[model samples]
Target: MPAGDSWLFEMKYDGYRAQAAIAGDQVRLYSRGGHDWTRQFGFVAPALATITKGTALIDGEICAIDQHGRSNFSLLKTSLDGRSPIVFFAFDLLEQNGEDVARLPQAERKARLEALLTDLPADSPVIYSQHVAGNGQQVFDAMKAGGFEGVIAKAPAARYYGGDRSTAWLKIKAVQRQEFVVIGWRPPEYGVDNVRGLFLATYEDGQLVFRGAVGTGFTDKMRREVHEVLQLILADGPLDVKGMPRAEARACRWVEPRLLAEVEYTEVTPDGLIRHPSFKGLREDKPARDVHLEVQDA
Candidate 1:
């Protein structure tokens, strides 16, 4: 994170990036890729609709918060089964009252967003994503101690550039984590109908490249569910990945790289492999082709 009073730091959330479009009595929730997911996260609409009677557009994250008030990505899937509650943490106000606010500065947008959600009931699912101005190191230290994901430093004067990555926003992760495309898998040696590990890869310079396998961090149920999906999408030939070890290439049961998995790792090896990797869960909001090696800003 850059050290400056002009930078606004917000807690990086571990959840799906979503937008809420509220028009009169109608509220639609869209994914990061603009796919409508209102029905999937139905509980969000009522709380957001209560925010205004006119039209508004809000950018935020849909997260499953644990008992410690931490956003837990693993609980997101189980929440869909009605096991836990999910909420929307609105961070930016794109449009409000039929007025375009995308070009506004970060500070202005956040102020407007907070004001919009301030009147909501205490039990409301719509939340205002709070941020602290400056103190990059202090904020990072506090968040890391609290077991938070990371911090997003935003240029206070920067305007929101929808659908584009901007230099104005920088992310500093307390833990190294990102999404990877599942290229294939290794079947369990001793068990029937179980996967031993997942073969992962990411896009580099327009080509898919091998990243090594993640052998741990799977529950018995996850192994079963993932195995069922892998069976259906088996590829006729191996993926045209670069730098795959010969032994792994021979052992892999290649599959279409359409499945995306979120994984955490200790660090990236000099040879371009993730070390001490742990699987978090599968992510559907992002496409597999968009998965790439994320390098944090220094």
Candidate 2:
């Protein structure tokens, strides 16, 4: 369905997807994969506790904001390990008073989530993720102009899908960058020299899928550094990612899918290859198995 009066749009922050659950004096924070990262993002639980009294499950993103107020992806680890500025932007209320309200409509759930954080102190680590209902095109235009990542649109009447990706919740990006598992790398060639290109893949519907290669955007120094790491992780084959191009597969020197990289692209071709993809950097913090592609409808 097209975005309009029936949809809710919010800024899609670039950060760690997390869920914070608070019950009385106890609080816990979990990654999207269920890892307990409370020690890492230590400020989330306490701040959530100060405002939310009853047992509640809140869905949000833990992010570091820059001088321009945009979420900074590269600083996420710094926020966890150093004294960087960070905040947990809560956008949905999944449970309350020991009751699961995940099946509630999006608007109602968000309304309750806002009420739960109405009194959160400015210094608190938890901040409410604000949104505008409808007018999504306007938001997208603004995000593109401001160099913001994208806007997410959620069906106002849709139910939350726990630990699952759903089409009801969609993201429209101003920039196209995705994390890929580095299964292999081509040795430095080009008249210049370093690592040449990277063979990439991602998880889709819980299955590993080949996403083809990215050869551009690497500086000589970056190639040298990553080539060094690739030497240590060499393997006999790429993970069982299906649909790899025959020629690419024949040429690949496989490595373990233990590395992740961020890639900027123009679009995904119909056959699933990245169009004009360029390397952004290594995503040392993200796990290979957790990297997934956003499936676009035909």
Candidate 3:
């Protein structure tokens, strides 16, 4: 590949997408789909306001880094709840001084964002997302070697599209894992000893849609424990299944949508089902409404 001024790269943090918006003295922090999370985050919006003189909107992620200095999702909620240190990795400046900067080139926007956050306390939660020019393959290889999630590639000239995925900003992951709602289950096979597996789904537009079954990565003890929980929430049938391909649908028992699960998958199928999905564990910190899916590019 030819080296040029067109490409930029950033770290792919495994955390919650957050947007900090400030108007006058009022500030707000939002989760994906515009969910208000300001009160929970505590000081994110206010800190950003202190740096910028006027109204501003900052797009970023709320992450808790492990001892290795890499973002770790498993520690995010607990770290936040305990009022421990967290990092607000601000990547994009959407607006400043009531002026929209979404149309600005990526490099120009990042430069301005860097200048806005020139001085911050060493331990401040708010951090300006840093990027490197070119050397994507080398950086990605280093990420894999360092056991990092992945790296993101961006078109320096591309304009920002808030809350939307675009080719201009591409992400490639070395590991695949995310939270999903356990909507149902499949009982043990006629002669099988333990429960078969659980039916998992993710929300799209706040609507729960079936993803697939996760039967692997569970210990015998966990299988039995999860089975007991599903039994308690057993329901007549899937509550709001819009559709499912007959071939993919098997003998499964539908349960209420309450339990959340963290799953690891090799990829997301064309039909939006998770491929090679393995049950990591229960996601006690995440709510069912926050479950979602993203199919990686082939």
Candidate 4:
């Protein structure tokens, strides 16, 4: 695939990517990883019922936006009392009026989505994802200038390829630092009893990518915290990847990838790995997978 192509660009929202399917009065919300989040986000289902009649599959991010239009995931997680305003930034229409429209070109689907929301209330949970024609680079630049993570470029005429990581959808994220769980440890090539470095991995797009390991920036307290977590998951056995054991020694304790730390990095490698990443701190609000290497716009 080439670098830059004719594509529909949207802001890479900092929230869970969900597909909301409304059938008659029944609405089912599925996360990007295929998890049923219908119960967790009940507020959205009721709003979806009001706008959709027969059936509609809407692609969007379930985000909690503040007064300044900035997403607040931490606030969203804590204030689950059903009072916080959660908005669904509807970006695409997959199925409408009992017809499967995902096979149609993306431009057609987006047009349908836009027409559906044209007369709706602006403050409604559903908001049409904005796009500018013939200015992909400018859109990307504006997103970066606004301190956003990045942008995602989707082929305007592409079809919905479910459960498949295709280059048709390209994600460009802001270069930010984040820490990950030290799931396992790898030995040094030649050294004493000390291990070479810790293996860092995070879940993204339903898969785990080894974000390289961290040998430096380890404090005594950090090491102790990592060791304690590693000890617990070790008895269960080494963490499996693709049905095979991760490339780590038995002596190395395998920890559950639950811990969230902050790290800083400059760029992502050609293989979609983080480069020159350094530890920052623990982030209690974010999940391990959400901390994976940032996606870049192709």
Higher TM-score: candidate 2 or 3? 2
Residue-pair clashes per candidate: 0, 0, 0, 11
lDDT of 3 by residue, 1-298 (tens): 2146468888888777788887766788886666788877766666766785577788889887888888877677668666446879989888988777988999988998898888877677799888889887787889889999888788898899753357788777778877788877777767654567878888888888878888888788878888877778877765675455454455767778878887889887777888898876675445577566764532
Tens-place lDDT digits, model 1, residues 1-298: 6977878899999999899999977999998767899999988898888888889999999999888999999999898876777999999999988788999998999998888889998889888988998899899999999999999888999889864247888879999998899999998888689788999999887899988799889999999898998998999998899989989989999999888888999999898999999989888887677778888863
Candidate 4 lDDT, 250-295, residue by residue in tens: 4354567666555667776776566776654444444466555544
| Prediction RMSDs, each to the true structure | 1.6, 3.5, 4.9, 6.9
State the RMSD for candidate 4: 6.9
Candidate 1 wrong stretches, greater than 4 Å: none
**Cα lDDT for residue 60, candidate 4:** 86
List per-prediction Cα lDDT, in the order shown. 0.89, 0.80, 0.77, 0.67
TM-score of each model, paired residue for residue? 0.95, 0.83, 0.76, 0.69
Minimum summed lDDT over a 10-residue window in model 4 is located at: 240-249
Give candidate 2 regions above 4 Å deviation: 81-83, 187-197, 204-207, 215-238, 243-253, 281-292, 296-298
Better of 3 and 4 by lDDT: 3
User: Any runs in candidate 3 off by more than 4 Å, and if so which?
Assistant: 1-5, 178-182, 185-197, 202-210, 215-262, 267-275, 279-295
